[model samples]
Target: MLFLNELLDELQSGDYFLLYVLVSAIAISVIFAIIGTIVSMNKLVFIAGGVSHASFGGVGIGFLLAYHFGWKNFIDYSGPIYSALVFAMFVATVIYFLTRHQKRYSDAVIGAMWALGMAIGVICIERVPGLKISIESYLFGSILYVNSLDTIILCILAVILSILFFVFYKTILSMSYDEEFASIRGIPVNLLYFITLQFISIAIVLSINFIGIILVIALLTMAPYIMERFLHSMKQIVMGAIVLNLIFCICGLAIAYQFDMNTGPCIVVFAAIIFFISISAQKVLKKA
Candidate 1:
């Protein structure tokens, strides 16, 4: 009852920042669940990781361009996310073309891209004159600081990703299981693969705001993988991932509020704990 009353007080106060945080959390959960399911099905965890880091190069470039164009306030306007989105898309495309037929070398190429992208970012940041950028925010994330624009963008992305997956569910499934069979069925395999990469790129870039690039892959992989251990169907796995992610985000946020801890790491740490618990449960069940 006391907790409910304090919650009611916070609600009655009409905190717009709190509202934004809620919306961002909800939208991001939806996005992460869908993308996590897809990426896990496709087994493209490395691709997601590569794109997440490669997008950092875009952040550095965006910062440089924004400053040169006399838009010092651009960074606060979510310029880095957009810039990274473009770069991520490009990186995704490059990875697809180069690795489509070279399964043996894909990992090596991806590693190179990942390292080069961050190196480029480091150089760009160094070239900026009198610029005070906190790499930690970009490295870790600052979900509490998301503004109205970001919340709106996340809502739109959540809708877009949901609609795309719903309408093309079988097509995505077919491609994920057997690309040659999907192509034989006239499912536009190449186009779908390209499209998947783009969506993955978008998911990675947008999530950088909440989970940060370093831990973003965990958000894309952990929930889906956990669900796959117990769930059978794709839809079930997606729904389960969404619920689990929501639980993590909400509980993590509450703990962060109560303890004045960093929201991003709190959420991540909570998810990690749950992940290990799930693993232990699975092992026990298997032994039985």
Candidate 2:
């Protein structure tokens, strides 16, 4: 009806950026859900969390370089961003390799690295001058600002990540379920671990512009974790995660539009509410 007509009119009037932002948010949520499920199954949540937060360093470096080279345009900035992501992925891999053998203090090491990465990002941003963009948006994502390019990049990354996941699904499942057994059966467990960490790093980098570094970890881990409780299998978990993510995105967008709120925080808050309800329901059912 009338609402539908108005929606169509908005689309025709080039005010569809909100829709694009929702799409990008869903893309990010799906990517993180996949990564979160994989890492959770493997009991490597801390490491993945580390990689997620550490990606801010990549953003800082990219922004600094882009500003220095007078490349404020999107196309010119893409290269440095990708290069910084490559560096972040390398750092994540090295951290993984270094801490993989440690038994008691691995989380501590990863936490230290995460803090160091954020510190470096802050320092880099402070050193850079004449940058007009708000660093907070990059650190804590303002999804309302996502443009067509961001949406396209998100879709492309999702497709590529999906293909990679499908090709190695069984092997990765095996490794996550039982790495020692997977290694015994010649499953290349170490290589799989490294690739998973790299994938997580890349996803985090891509999501920095939508969810911010501080809140990205929640979007990456919480939605999937909540859905996993209700789903009986990995496939079902993924499906449920996507559905929940879409719901949150739509509701968040509507709320942001109605209340003049920040989109990223609104989305995260919606996710938190959903998570709380899920957990409470589970508790009630268990009591019953």
Show where candidate 1 strays beyond 4 Å.
1-11
Per-candidate local distance difference test: 0.83, 0.74
Report clashes for each candidate as comma-separated counts: 0, 0
Best by TM-score: 1
Provide the clash count, candidate 1.
0
lDDT of 2 at 246: 74
Whole-model lDDT, candidate 2? Answer: 0.74
Error at 43, model 2, angstroms: 2.5
Error of 2 at 225 (Å): 1.2
Writing each residue's lDDT as its tens digit, candidate 2 over 1-288 gives 332354578788978865676678678767877787786677767776777677667767777777677766732334445755876797787787788777577877888878877787778878787667777776677764677887898888888877777798778778877889899999988788887888888887777767776777777777678977877677667667777777776776667666766667877899999899999999999999
User: Model 1, range 1-288, lDDT digits (tens) per residue?
Assistant: 332345567688975666677778888889999988989988899998999898899888888888788887775537777888898899999999999888899999899889988988888877778876566777777765588888898899999988988898888888888989999999888888788889989988887767788878887788889999999888899889988888888787777777776677888899999999999999999999
